[model samples]
Target: MVPEPEFRSYYGQPIIKGPLWHEPHMPAYLYLGGLSGASSLLAAGCELTGRDRLAAPAKIAAAAAGTAGAAFLVAELGRPERFLNMLRVFKTTSPMSVGSWILAAQSGLAAVAAGSALTGLLPSIGKAAGLATGITGPMMATYTAVLVADTAVPSWHTGHRELPFLFAGSALASAGAVAMVAAPHREAGPARRMAMVGAAMETVAGEVLERRLGLLAEPYREGSAGRLMRAARVLTVTGGALAAVSGLTRWRTPSVLSAAALTAGSLCVRFGVLRAGRASAADPKYTVVPQRERIDARERNRAHGR
Candidate 1:
């Protein structure tokens, strides 16, 4: 067998720098932003379906998570003003710019809905605001995936096609879990169903990402990142199964357990994705191999044409 090509960078340094986002804060924000975004949509849907009991909890979850996620994002930036600066200009080419606007609108609408639901003030306005989130809510949930994928991080950039679905599914699971935990059991059937669906989507998309990426997927399937992904998979599958059971039997215990598992699993997915990106960026092999493969493929195509 031909000896494997050795990979190295200048002085063994990485070809590209990893993300500057700090741990806990960035991942926490990701989790919360997703929860808030998806919950807003769920709240609006519940209201339309006349499930006020379920809608109330969804509103509260959306509002609380949105505010908390904003705080975490600000923390990651080390200043709230830094976040506001991004809002000064919106650019179609910039995922961050678009995401900032989406976050602002989703958060504001969620807060208004929660406030109105809690205080019974401006009910009409609150209802309108809640409904409006459906336009921005999905963007809020999956825009982060775009933001990260736009970067040079190999793991994230390579998985762009699936990242949005992964994030969207995770967001749905998180929001649904909260509703399952907070809303009355009988009234939370939609939430349970949503959680199960989200879990299935996340799990399947993740598997596809790993399989399709081949060697590039090593970071996501090894070391701490691998451990976290495995844990997320277990929790998500178990939670989804439990959610289905709880939905049919109306078992409160199973409902609560399912909620806990789904939330934890969603958080794990965010953390694992970030870790995988970091690992891939810190190594030269991941970047070099992909470039070499593309070059080889192009050369082969040219030769064939000749």
Candidate 2:
């Protein structure tokens, strides 16, 4: 066979640049963000349904996760003092900055809601905070899509539209899973329903993104990312079905198993998304060709207008 052409990096160094932060930092951030967002949603649902006992844990978890995740993000920035720089300006084009603000607001609201639950004081204020958190929680759950999409990574940027939905769904399932584990069956009904809804949304969004993202989608369907995402889909679907059916019959074992499955599936989605982004960034073709084509297309359009 003919010898394969040798590939050389600039200055004979590596072509792919790994992320600045360690894997633990990034992966933990993903898990924490999902957990926090889902917890807020669960808390809100519990409050609405008069399940105060369930709301207590959900609120506390949301607050803790939100605050801790924000701390990790600041730490990952490498210079703790420079964290304020993120809030110095508001630019719609900068997803990082916007997401930071969202996270900040979410964390604050969650803290208040949690504190109120713990103190058993200011019930009205707690309700208000819970409502506010419910609004911000969804944004926290899904804005990572916009954050990743804004990057130069091909797989992530291409899947931007669907990523938000995927994250939101995963967050919902994760929160539901936690509630199912902690609350009584009657109190956990809303959690099960939320999990089913989230799972369904995640599966649909992932399928659509995989089908519509063209070549960039390859990363999510061909290697480790593919394996994780496929597993996520299967587990989510199966678990969600069980959750839905559990409502019809009060089978504690099946309900518990389904909740566990949903939690695992949600974690897989986060890991798979991160892996797909890394894979997209590592491939030169993914980074260069699409951008070059876009530039060419823009130039052609300008010339035609002239």
Using lDDT as the measure, which candidate wins?
1
Q: Which sections of candidate 1 miss by over 4 Å?
A: none
Instruction: Report per-prediction Cα RMSD to one decimal.
Output: 1.1, 3.8
CA-lDDT, candidates in order: 0.92, 0.82
Quote model 1's TM-score: 0.98
Question: Top TM-score: which candidate number?
Answer: 1
Candidate 2 Cα outliers beyond 4 Å, as residue runs: 1-21, 291-306
Error of 2 at 123 (Å): 2.3
- Cα lDDT tens digits, model 1, 1-306, are 999867777887898988988899999999999999999889989989999999999999999999999999999999889999999999999998888999999999899999999999999999999898877788899999999999999999999999999999999998989999899988998999889889999999999999999888999999999999999999999999999989778569998899999999999999999999999999998999899999999999999995
User: Poorest 10 consecutive residues of model 1 by lDDT?
Assistant: 4-13
